[model samples]
Each structure stands twice: as structure tokens, then as C-alpha cells.
Target: MKKNKNLLEVPNINSSDAQLKKIIYKVEDNIFNRFFNSFSKSEYLCVCSGGTTSSCARDNFITLDLRKEYDHIHLEKEKNLIKIGGGVIMKDLMNFLGSQNKIFPTGLSKLPGAGYLLTGGISPLSRRYGLAIDNIETIKGYLGNGTFISLEKNNLSSDQKLLWEGFKGAAPFLAIITEIGLKTFQAHPIQIIEGFINDNELSKIINLAEGFPENLSLQWIYAQDIYIYILAEIRNDLDKEITKKYLNKLENFSSLKIKTYENYNQINFFPKELDLFELNKNNHSEVISLLGEDLKERIQIFIKCMKEIIRSKPNNSCYVASQQLGGKTKEIDPKSSFFIHRKSTWKPWIYASWKKDDLKEKEIVLNWMNESWEKLKIFFPKIHLAQIHNHLNSHEEEVYLSFEERLSELKTLKNICDPESILPPL
Candidate 1:
């Protein structure tokens, strides 16, 4: 394949040294089929929806950029469902769904693309409604062997049924999704309570949140300071009183702020200091996400280890943050998707970063991230394959941990669907 020197660079959210040999834009049926048939088997292949995952492109790989061509969003009111193209991001999806008085499970930040849904999207709202994958009703994509496939929940052959199960949580390894159909819920009134607290209060909050109803979820971050955020969906006056009572039980909170929003898109989950725009731009970062049960008795020891990790931070951006995930998320059957760790109550991610092109700082920060993961692994035994790290040494281990007993089955499907290994390796 000849390189397209004039083609604009793939704008990935996570800045990395990985380079693309050529970028194919406007991937219509003709272009996609032609490219898929023409590329040599030795050439690596990947897709860029919102340009977030590291595995989207490797050194000299041919990348398909979906941002321009596959961004259509349509709502099917009769079924209360929405169909979004591969290129759509969380912000656009939320804003569009909000206008229609509908909601979907999206992450705390709004920039991730289809990969978020493909990797089993976890949101504060996920505690009530299920994971993003659980909402998928239809998927249209090309399998690794250059065959166009469209599968719906209601109609599927045995092979397609197996492919459907794999697409839910292990899509990137199976095919290139061009569009997805998702079930949307009626938008509801929501409230947010945010405050900064010390280590002691953090433990207290975690314990208190463990017993919270499905409508309430907790997300906490330990950066320069510890910040706790609570998301409550108000179905009635009772929920409001219950949220207030929980707040009253807390001992101390700095800069406590409470606000209610009429819909999902109207809410801002992060503080001004940790702006999403700033975090995405002008920085190179890596993240490793973990799934674990409630800390409970291990809260104190976990906190101690966390404090040490925070104190030894390589930079201001390196920190640990966790989100609550148990309630409705656990209701789904384990066999339904590749997300086997449904028993998890918390999803904590270790993040490390350095200035772009700062190789020395990159080495130091990556070391810190791995070391921090080593200390916290005992508490968080399962890994979450949220962000792809195929280029890193932990890729195989993370993939295995993400899908333990199911790995062998997924591999068998990989051989049948992706004999040439066109998609990311299993």
C-alpha cells in the first residue's frame, strides 16, 4: 500500500508515537471493500472512531478514520431506540438524546467514541440501567475477512449469534463496527453532590455508598486532593430526601456543592480544574482500569497504599480515580457478554502522563503507573479492557484478565471469523 503523505494525521485522544502508514477516509462500501481486498495480509489494520484507543493504530499500520463519514445519528421513536454511526462521540450522543428526552449510559468524560460502548460502557447511570453493551440491539460491521455483516438481537444464525455475543464486549478484536443501535431510556431528573475530602472521609464515603440504592452512584478521584462526587437520579421526593440524608451523615467536606439537572447532557461531572478539554489536548497519557469488589474491611489498607502512590506521583496528571458499578450492572447474565467480572462493585483506573515527546518523563511515569498497579492489584483482581494497550507488554495479560475463562472461546471464534488476523490480535 502506498502512503498518503498529504492525508491529515489521525487525531487520537491519547497521544502516542504510533504512526499510521495511510489513513482511509469516507469509508463507504466501495472503498472499504476495495481496501480490505487489496491490503496485503502482512499489513496491520485498525479503526479510529474518536481516536482514543492505543490499538487504533500501530507503527505503519493502515488506519480507517470514521470521524467524517460515519457520524449519522437517528432515533427510532417507535421502538425508543437510537442508531449512531461509529464516529459519534459521547457529547454529541448525549446532546442529541437529551433533546429527545432520552438517556444512554455514557462515561464521566464525553470525548470517547464507539470504543467506549464496545468495551462495555460504565457510567454513574449504569447502576440503574445496565451497561452500554446491554443496550445494544443491532450492530453493522465488517468481519476480519472482509465480509459485511449485520446482526440484530431478534434475528441471527448460530454463527451470527456467537458473533453477536463477541461483539458486545470484544468487538475490536472481532470486527470493525460502522454503526450501532442502542436502547434509550426516558430522561429523568438528576442531582449531583460534589466535595473534596481527606482520606478518612474518603473511606467513610465509600462505605456509605456501598449500600446505596441503584439510583445513587459514587465516583471518587485522588489527585492533588481527594474529590468525591455523587450522582443521584431522582424519581420522586423520596430519592431527594434519601440523598439529603446521606449528605447530612457525612462528617466533613470541603467546597461541597449540590446541584440538580433536568437531563443527562446538562450535567457537568468534573470540576473546572480537571477540564475535559485540557486533559485531552497537549498531553500524552496511559491508563489501566481495574474491576474489584467493595473495599469494606480493606478500605484502610487500600487508602494507605493509595496515599503513598499519590505522594510519589510523577506529575500532577498522574492519579487514581474510581467509579461505582454494581447494582443493575450485575443483573445481566455473565454469558451475555465478555464482561465476566459483573460482580465488581468498583472500577478504578490508574493514570500516568508526561509532556509530549518527553521520552525520559514517559519512562518514569509509565514505571510509576505499573508500580501503582502492582500495589493495588490484590484489591482489584480483574482488569478492564477499556483502553487498548496492544503495544505494551501488559496487552496479553490485560486481555486475559479481562476475559478469563471465556478467552478460549473467544479465541476459537477469532480463528473462524478472523483467520488472517485482520483485526487486533486475540
Candidate 2:
């Protein structure tokens, strides 16, 4: 593994406090803050992928960066398994896997951390194979006091499986993850195809997604119903002809522009090992959360709302679009820690981010996202899976507090694992 240029390397655990202190002084602020913050909390809100968890933590409890302090990976080349450090970032792990021509499920963004995903993940590839933790072989962490233990597939005895089953989707309780032993795969060839629909041809957009194959996953984004983005991932030769099939169907819509990234694996090979901090660290100009049905009318309605929001904040560069919770993901036994939807799962988020100083603009976009969330509640009731964490805008926040039982369980795990609360807490 190569050293990241921007941050100094963390020394092996054997170093003296004086030496460790000197070494840590040279790293980046977020990473450093996160590293020290991990152990400082007698209780903490640990954060990984989505930024909101950290935001919420800062407001409610003591928080820290688990990315450095807790995330540890130990690769066993002979065993064909890697004990991943809890703090590992998404790009680093995916890129590492890419290098091996291997694959694991990942969220819409290439930058989310593995810590967040394996515990409660929703990835582009999750539909067919499984959610992040669905593929897990084992989990190793703490019940409390820095004592480490490993949970393996063999440990899923009838009695233990019952307890483990209860912990999925809910936050961690009774343990803090130090590392996870994950099942890895040889690379699967893939392709990326994107569709852009014109404002008027919106009906066809929904039709296209509805028609996507089991092997193909697509996301539709409506920007005031005027700008719609649909991104799809196609596995090798499932339909062999879906490429042309989708292209032709999309053409029926007026003013549609599409980009088909054939042989996408060739472009984004496994284990490419890109640095995560490099990617996620660059926040988008604008991100406002929205909720909508995977269906077209809901998307159109959301887009109309977004158009008004984006128009006011032109700097808002992009909105994340996803079709969440179809495929085998829904099929997975809801009991596994891998699956976490209390209700219907919407597609990936349409995330928007702006500069630090853009308070007024930020307020406008965030309010729009919240308003969009509230506006769509009636339609959302139709979804039977689970709502994602990010969409819990102002109103959604209250709704999420309902999951406290599960969350409380996760917190119990944290207390037991890092009684000092040094590890990241959800």
C-alpha cells in the first residue's frame, strides 16, 4: 500500500505516546480530528459515509472520527479474506478490490466509507449480489473496554443467529466494530449507461426505469421535471442487448440525451484504489435532500420542487439520483445486520452541497429539500421497504427518532465495545 500524500501515515500501535503525538501532528485536520475524537468520547456519535450522521452527532452527542482510530484491516492472503479496519474509506477499499479485479457492493457514490456500508449500506451493486454486510463472513469489534473478539459465519449458531438477526438495520448496540472479515470476489465486468431526458418527455423516463432488467439498475433524477438523469449499471451479457434496448426506448422521448459507457469495467477496473478523502472531501456546490417514489409522477413532482430550489441557488452543481431497494436487496432476510430498512427504501439520494460561507444559499436549498420531503409524505407511504438516512430532512428527522429501539441497541453495543466511548457511535 502506498502512503497518502495529503495525510501523514499512522504508526503501528506499538509506538510511544510522544512519538505518536509527533506523527499525528502532521496529518490533515478532518482525519486528525476524527482520529483523536474517536477515543476522546466516553460516548460518541461515530460517523463514516453520509455527512448528516456527523452533523446530527455534533448537535446531539459527543462525536469523533472513527476513520482513523477504529477502522483496521488485516488481509489474510492465504485465507482469501481481509479483516477490514472500521475506518477504511470507500474509494480505498473499492480501488483495492479493483486492483484484484474483485468487487463488493457500494453505494451510489464512489466515495462512501466501508464502515458505514457494511453496517447499513445501500449500494448500486447491492440489488443483485447483496447489501454490503450481506456478503460479510465475520465481524470483529468490542463489547467494551477495548477487548477484541471476532464474529465468524460459524458463530451463527441457531441461538446466536437470533441475537445477530435482531441487530441489523438498527444502530449498533453492545459492541463497537474494530474490524470486519469480508468475503471478496473476483472482478465482474460491468458497464455504465446514463440517460438524460428532456423536460416534456418525462413520462418515458419512468417507463424506462420500470422496464430495466433484473441485472440492470437505473436511477432517474428530475430537476424541476426539466432536467432528469437516469444512470444504470448492467452486468455482463445478461441481456447482451439491453444496451440497445434502453437506448431505443429512451429515444422515443423528445429531446433525450444519453451516454452509454460500454465496458465500464475497463474504465473503472477493480482495485483502482483511489483515495476516498480526495473524492468525498470536495463537497458539491449544492445538495438538498428530496424524497420521491421510484415512479415517474413522484419524480416529476420532486423535480418541479427542485427546479424552484436550484434556480435560486445556481451554484448548486449536482443532485444525487438513485433507484434504491429493488432486486435481491429486498429479498435478503430482513433479520441480517446487512439489511436496514424499517419501511420502503427509496432510490439513492439526490445530494447537493455548497461552500462553507453560503449560509443563506444553504438555508434556501436545505429548506427546499425539507419541503420536498414533507410534500412527498403522502406518496412515500406507498413504499413498503425503508426510507434512507439522508432524506430524513427536518420533518423526516422526527420520523427517524421512531427507530430508537434499534438505535438504542446499537448504542449499547458502543458502550460495551468502547466503554470510554472512544470509538465512533452512530
Candidate 3:
């Protein structure tokens, strides 16, 4: 079960190769109780960390290509903090957070799985420090009843009541979260603007980025051309030349142009010399996170969920992105299971990642993103809450609710932590 062209490798297993499988060799300490009871019957005992992300406590776990178990270890980081090795790999945690000049809300291609971008919420300074599971304050590893605690973020609700068992997007089945104490930042060092447009002043550049403010950090990519990234957070040094007057106000309101400015701490943010994680693009992309609050009824619930995602494709393309939940992301308190969108407005995704094995055309792109969340429940009386599996064709996984009690406590926490559901094959 060890195959890899490059799911983005970041190995570590030595002691002179004492047969490393699905890695988690914690240098003795009572042999971590025989590797946690041989990983509770091993249906999938992964710790695979290197972008594509893994540590499947049981998603029927299968990801064993430990790059012949590479033994490249060298740890040490500071400037706010970092302590990696949950199989580390977003371009080696951006060359160790740009050698501690620091930065961490990760994503924007350094290859995914910075713990699948902080336990699958979102990042890239998620509208400036919000999700990345609340900038995790600690993690440490091994669980499946073989115990080895150390969670943090004020004891993730008593460690999800002594270790999460499963469901609503089962945190890959809780535990093997090894070494993720991140929470760093301070690398702005000035300059980082990008632009390109194909036409249609994209609704007055999304209305001057919804009336820009809060030290700007904007994006709106339609891929293949129609991208715009303007991020500025100089923290004085003479306002770093006011980012060239915001790149001359995005070249006087768009029409295709300019790119690059350097100093997002000098780029090279990861995607190591090519080989993009062996692109076997079996299509995937359907993320929605607009917790609603009438932006003209969220643009009429996005044109009625864009006519069911343009009839679920005949070559489709989508990506909405508004981002900015207000300084420090709604200052927590949405019930705080790390990040349950206290007011998450704008984050539409819906891609069409080609590579069909025709499982009914990938269930018509997940049934057209579950019929755009059932036409966003006819603008669900202007929604307000709901988290975890943030709607990607919902079985409605909750973290805190409002959509009628997160679909009945996410179906009783998936019938008491995955009653035989073995997750995966989503």
C-alpha cells in the first residue's frame, strides 16, 4: 500500500529503518504502548503529513507511501512559535516559516494539507487570523485509546470529550495530530499585489472590494486568467510606500494587467520546483461558507445557486470568495469550537477537477454541490450559523447550530461517533 509519485513527501522514520509502515515511530518512551496497540486493529493507521494531508484515525485509512520513509529531521522555530512534525510539508512549512521571520495562516499553494489547511476550515490569513482551527495553540499526538494527550485551545472541549470518535467530516478520526503548535505571523515586510482581468469590470471590482478597509487582503480568482490578489499589512516603515497607492487603485479599476511585487516575505511560498503533487486530478472542489446576512440576499443566493451550478457542468467554473469576517474574524465566540464562522460571509468554491472514472460523473459534481445547498434553503430565512463540514453537499455536520439545530446535532454525532461508518470514499 505504499505508492507515491509525490503526494508531496515529508518523511521521517529512522532508528536505522526498523521497518517503518504508515509512520508514527515516536522514539520509544515505552514504545508508545506498542504503537498504540498496533493502531487499533489497523484498518488504516496513517500519520502521513506532507500537503495531501493524513493521519487517518480511520477513514478506512490508507495512505502508506512513506517516501521510503525519508529521515530528514531538523527542528527549531520561533518568533511567535512553531514546532512541527505532523509529517511537515507545505514546502517544508515554508522553509520553516521563512526561517522564523514568521507567517502562518497558510495556503495559496505551498501545496495543501498544512493539516489540510488547518483542519479543513481555510487560511491564507483567513481574512486575517480566523480559522486554521483558531490558530491552533497546541496538538501533540497518538490517540485511538492508546493515549498520549496534549490538545490545547483551552482543552478542545475536554479533548472532544477524551478523543473524538467520528463524523460530520470526522476529523480524519481524531488523533495522530502530532506536533502542530502554530500561531505565528509578522512577515508582511511589504509589497504583494497581483492582478489580471478578462473583462466585465467584475462588478466594479466587487464594489471596490466591498469597500476596502482593515489593512487590505483581497482575492478573486476565476482561474486561467481573472485573478487579483492585493494584500498589504506593512505595520509601518513609512507605510511601505502605501503599496504603490494600492497598485494605483488596481490600475484604475481593472482591465487585465500587472503582477508580482515580492515580499510576502520574498515569495517562493512553496510548490517546490514543480511536480505539483502528481496531479491525478480526480476532480474535487465544493466549498461554501457564507453564513449569510443579506448582501442583497447574498446576491440572490448567488443567482439561485447559479442555476444549480450551471446545470452541474458542461465544462463549469466557479469561485466566489469575498473574505473579511471583520478584524480577527468575528473575534471568536460563535461557540468557539476553534472556528464555527461567527459570521463567515463569502467563500463559494464549486470546482470541476477533471479525471473521471465516471462514478456517475462524480455524482454530477456531488449532485451539483447538493443542489447548491438546496438553493441555499431559499436564502434560509437569512441564515446565521452552522459549522464543521461547512456544506459540501451536507449530511449537515454541525459544530454549533441554527439550521434547525445543525440538522439534529448532526444526526446524533453520526450515531455515536461513526457507528461502523469507517469514513472515506466521500
Give me the candidate number with maximum TM-score: 1
Cα lDDT of model 1 by residue, 1-426, tens digit: 225452334445343356557777654556545665776766657778877666666667777778788999999999988999988988899999988988998989787899999999999899999899999999998877767888898898886777898998999888888899999998889888887788988887888998898999999989888887899998778887987787787635656678789977787776566542235355688889999998889998999999999999887778899999999999889899988999999999988888767889989999999899899999998998998787788889999999999999999988977877777786
Which runs in model 3 stand beyond 4 Å of their true positions?
1-42, 46-79, 82-103, 108-114, 117-139, 142-175, 186-219, 223-227, 249-251, 254-350, 353-358, 363-426
TM-score for model 2? 0.66
| lDDT tens readout by residue for model 3, 260-295 | 433353454213243222233334333434444324
lDDT, model 2? 0.47
Once superposed on the true structure, which residue ranges of model 2 sit more than 4 Å away at CA? 1-80, 144-147, 157-175, 221-236, 253-320, 338-345, 348-365, 381-426
- Model-by-model lDDT, in order? 0.83, 0.47, 0.45
Q: How far is 385's C-alpha from truth in model 1 (Å)? A: 0.4
Ranking by lDDT: 1, 2, 3
User: Of the pair 1 and 3, which is ahead by TM-score?
Assistant: 1
For model 3, the local distance difference test gives 0.45
Instruction: Report the C-alpha displacement of residue 117, candidate 1, in angstroms.
Output: 0.7
Ranking by TM-score: 1, 2, 3
Error of 2 at 30 (Å): 24
